[model samples]
Target: MAEPFHIGFLLFPNLTQLDFTGPLQVLARLPGAKLHLVAKTKGPVETDCGPFLLADTDFNDCPKLDMLCVPGGFGIDQAMQDADTIAFVKRQAEGARYVTSVCTGAFILGAAGLLKGKRATTHWAWHSHLARVGAEPVKARVVRDGNLFTGGGVTAGIDFALTITAEIAGESVARAIQLGIEYDPAPPFDSGAPDRAQPETLEICERRYAGRVADFEAALAAALG
Candidate 1:
């Protein structure tokens, strides 16, 4: 029998749950897929939103994956500075068919030197930092540059998953999965982007995120070091 397509999502403390779960809802349905939730150690990892998730495998035990996914959230600052995590990503990406990330997770990939000269995207708040890590940032929901795929913000992971599914299993398979999940989105809000959001709304968001920017900048420098 053919080998199951082994896929792993790197798990860490304080990551955005939707960044990983949204994509998992789609990719888990791919034909022949075997999913692994990986971490530096085997145990529960907390999400930014307060839930704890178990890491099914640790770095030493994780087999070389067919696909490697990293999710981003408030904990991204710490992840970027984590030597073991960066080394694991670099090692897996060396053999994986695809190297992908969601939201600020691309920052982790960039830290591993996978985004050099590659076009990528991340949460709009952190898009400017991509260049600091040597990636050419594109402001898109999903940016695909060769085997590197990146999703912007939190919910874009769903869109990224379908795109990756199509790339791996063919469009028909992706379409079937989409229909199965009723993936059609008709969001009631039009203020998702900076260009569309009211000035006051943007200011409020900027204020909320202002305090974390310095921490991120420091982490990026450490990661790139």
Candidate 2:
């Protein structure tokens, strides 16, 4: 039998659940693919909403993956600051055939210095932060630079994964998966991106995440030292 294509996803406390799970659900359905939920340590990791998820494998035990996925959330601030986590991402990305991130997970990739001088995108709220991390931020739902794929916000993970499937498996497989999921997204709200959102709404989101920004800034400073 052919070797399975292994995909590793990083799990950290306070991570945005959709950022990883949405993509995982799609990718797991692919034939002959192995998925590994990797964490710095073995055990349960909590989401931002207080749900705990059990990881399938610890980082140390996992082999080099065909793809490495980093999901973004409030927890990413902590992960970015963690030397161990950053080092793990850096090492895995170096060997993985594909390196990818969802939403603020791009920040974690940036923290690992994988995005320097690269064109990328992240949650609209963090576009400036992406620039701060030495990446050229693009205004798009998904940005692909070489083998690195990045998506914007939580829901964008689905799009990124579908795109990856199209690239790796085939367009027919990606279309089948899309049709299986019935993924015809029609957001009730008009504001998904900053440019589409009202200035006031954008301000509110910025203010709401101000503390996280500060925390991430400090963490980046320490990590860069």
Candidate 3:
């Protein structure tokens, strides 16, 4: 039998727990696949909600992976500004067969110089910022530009994983995983994306995250220096 495909998930402090966990659950159910939660250090990492998650391995100890997944949250802005994290991401992505990001994880990838001239996506609120980092921003739920796949906001990670599984393992496997997860989704509100949202709603979201956005811009500028 062939050896199982190895997948590494980059974990950092303040990461969106669901962004990583949701896809980890789906991928773990697949046959003959190994998953590793990798962090800068092998210890418990805290999420934005204050919960702690134990990582399986440190970056130095992580084995070569067939796929690398980066999940995002407010913490990503910090990670993007981190020189050590950016260097690690660039190195790992260069070695991994496929590199992917969830939500604002694209910011980290962009910081690593992985998204240059590549089409990518991120949370709707941060799409323009993505373009500023030299990535051609696409407003899709999942944008697969070659070996680099990126998704929109938090929930889009699930869809991105399914799409990638279909490409890698096959449509049957993807469909089975989707079914196993009971993937049907119905939002009470119709405004999932900025284009679909009411002007007032978009305005509110922009205002709410304005300070965060400002901080992110400052961080990106510093990281790029």
TM-score (all chains, Cα) for each model: 0.98, 0.95, 0.96
Best by TM-score: 1
Give lDDT tens digits, candidate 1, residues 92-160.
Answer: 999999999999999999888899999999999999989988899999999999999999999999999
Ranking by lDDT: 1, 2, 3
lDDT of each: 0.94, 0.89, 0.89
TM-score winner between candidates 1 and 2: 1
Tens-place lDDT per residue, model 3, 1-225, is 988789989999999988888788787876777999899899899998888999989878988888889999889878888777888888888888789999999999998999999999998878898877899999899998889999889899998999888888899999999998899999899998787899999899999999988888888888788
lDDT of 3: 0.89
Ranking by TM-score: 1, 3, 2
Residue 8 Cα positional deviation in candidate 1, in Å, after optimal superposition: 0.5
* Model 1's TM-score against the true structure: 0.98
> On TM-score, who's better, 1 or 3?
1
Q: Per-residue lDDT for 106-191 in model 2, tens only?
A: 98999888999999999876778887678999988889999999999999999999999998999999999999999998989888
Question: How many clashing residue pairs are found in candidate 2?
Answer: 1
Error of 3 at 20 (Å): 1.0
Output the worst ten-in-a-row residue range by lDDT, candidate 1: 215-224
